[model samples]
Target: MSSPSTPAGDLAFVVRTIARTAVDNEGAFGDLDAVAGDGDFGYSLARGFEIVLADWDTLDPGTPDEFLKKVALVISKRVGGTSGPLWGTAFLRAAGAVKDRTELDAADAVAMLRAAAEGIKARGKSDLGDKTLLDALIPMTDALEQRLAEGGPGAGPAELAALAASTARTSADATTSMQARRGRQSYTGERSIGSPDPGAVAVAVMAERVAAEWDVRD
Candidate 1:
């Protein structure tokens, strides 16, 4: 089957893969989030994505930015906690990157990711190695940029998605061994060693889901 690039394709993948992510992460995100903040993160996220997928068609956000803004607003209203705002911001920024696109190319995807990373950093003021979503965002953006540069902007979404997944996973997994120096988890100090940050987990889940949905598995 041809891979997804248009709004319809993005819609289909998002609906199915988001549910898969919630199933995969289960309580892990909630449990860790409870340590320093409200415990509703995973639940809120799952609920929000469920809602987003269900009304995804009706959303008809017009442009990518509008689509993301709609999701951000919907998620913020329907779900409670920092997760709603954080995820909303990420989507909003990515959406902004492709406001003019009906279908995102490899370069367009890279722009989306770079915008996403910048949004997270701007909102959180955290840098790479802080063990936040930037952990995944930085690597993922770099991977996309490298792939696009080497293979040209015409590189397929599946291949780009594959590289993005690999990079995100690497960043997410590496956090398990490192100490979190950012966000609420920073207070945990060495205690945060064994558990991955919920935000990082969320990033990994989103990237992996998008990769699979787009038929990009490495």
Candidate 2:
């Protein structure tokens, strides 16, 4: 395969990719949210992406950081509930990680993902095993980091992203057995065990998108 293009084009592709993912999974996300939240997770994300699509032409194409900052602003302002701020913060953190970079390599992608995961952790004040999005994100980032650390000469962004995506799916599935420790779902005590966290599902979706869309070449 070929290497991915510069950050500016990558941003545009990622936006479109996420928008499609949101629309495709909105119903399932709502169903998952209905298990613990107000069932608005899907609608909120779809709406936020809709706004992004509408404003696609205006997004800055100069750098990945600027584009992600714009994305964060839109998600925070247009989406409602905790998801808005949480996701926005993640994107913002990613933007900061890549600030001033015109292109992103495999290691940069790993760093950005790691930054986003840490952002979610700090912003949500949540931890692993919290039965939140962190469950999926943390594990995925860990897997990516491990790949980057171990695969020395051959590891590429697409391969690492695929590994992370697989880990995300597994982590998200594991959430079904974990009782919620934070968020409104915590009120359910043991009753929330049957359903996975919607946010976790969304994180898995993001991982999948990155794995599919990112170009990986040495």
Candidate 3:
């Protein structure tokens, strides 16, 4: 499997990976969500991504941003629960970040992630340390940006992705110590402290999958 060399190809690879991850981990994600909130996170995510996969052949692949925007529409419209709006907003903002760009570099990737984080923050009315996915997403983005800034030898795409994935996993784990301040889990207050945020865990899992499979995607 050859790696994608173009922006469109790269976007396709990433979206496919995320969709597959969500679909494959449905039961696990639902179980994690059950520990805190209602066990619908996995179902909502899988349903949304299932639509994406089902409509893969029909979505335009002319540009990365265009593809992402279409995906956002699908997620927002087809997915149920709060997951739809939050994740859809993330993708929409990401698409906006790179609008009209013919190509993308590390900086563009960081910018897209930042935009997505901001979108999530705005849509979910949440922030870092809220025991939401932001806890993992923000740190992962920061790690990627920092790694890119450092720019040492061998700090390529795969290495940066691995670093982000590691950061996401660690940050997601840290959420176990934080009481949920947002979302349905917040209703349980201190009870949410013992379990990590399902959204954060999902982000970590997806990042890990992307990193592990980066070299093999085409």
Residue-by-residue lDDT tens digits, candidate 3, 84-155:
999999999999999988787888889999999999999999999999999999999998888888888868
Candidate 2 vs 3: which has more TM-score: 3
- Positional deviation of 157 in candidate 2, in angstroms? 3.0
- What is the C-alpha local distance difference test score of each model? 0.71, 0.81, 0.91
TM match of model 3 to true structure: 0.96
Where does the lowest 10-residue lDDT sum fall in candidate 2? 1-10
Error of 1 at 179 (Å): 1.9
Q: Name the candidate, 1 or 3, with the larger TM-score value.
A: 3
Best by lDDT: 3
**TM-scores of all predicted structures:** 0.83, 0.90, 0.96
Q: Give the candidates in order of lDDT, highest first.
A: 3, 2, 1
Off by over 4 Å in 2: 1-4, 152-154, 213-218
For model 2, name the residue pairs that clash.
none
Residues 56-112, model 1: lDDT tens digits: 666653355666667777666766666666667777888788876665455766787
The alpha-carbon deviation from the true structure for residue 31 of candidate 3, after best TM-score superposition, in angstroms, is 0.4
Residue-level lDDT tens digits of model 2 in 1-218: 11236545555666667777887788989888998777898988988878877887788756789888998899999888887898899889989999988867767777887898899889888999999998998888788777777867557655676788899999999999999988778887998898999989888897798677676311
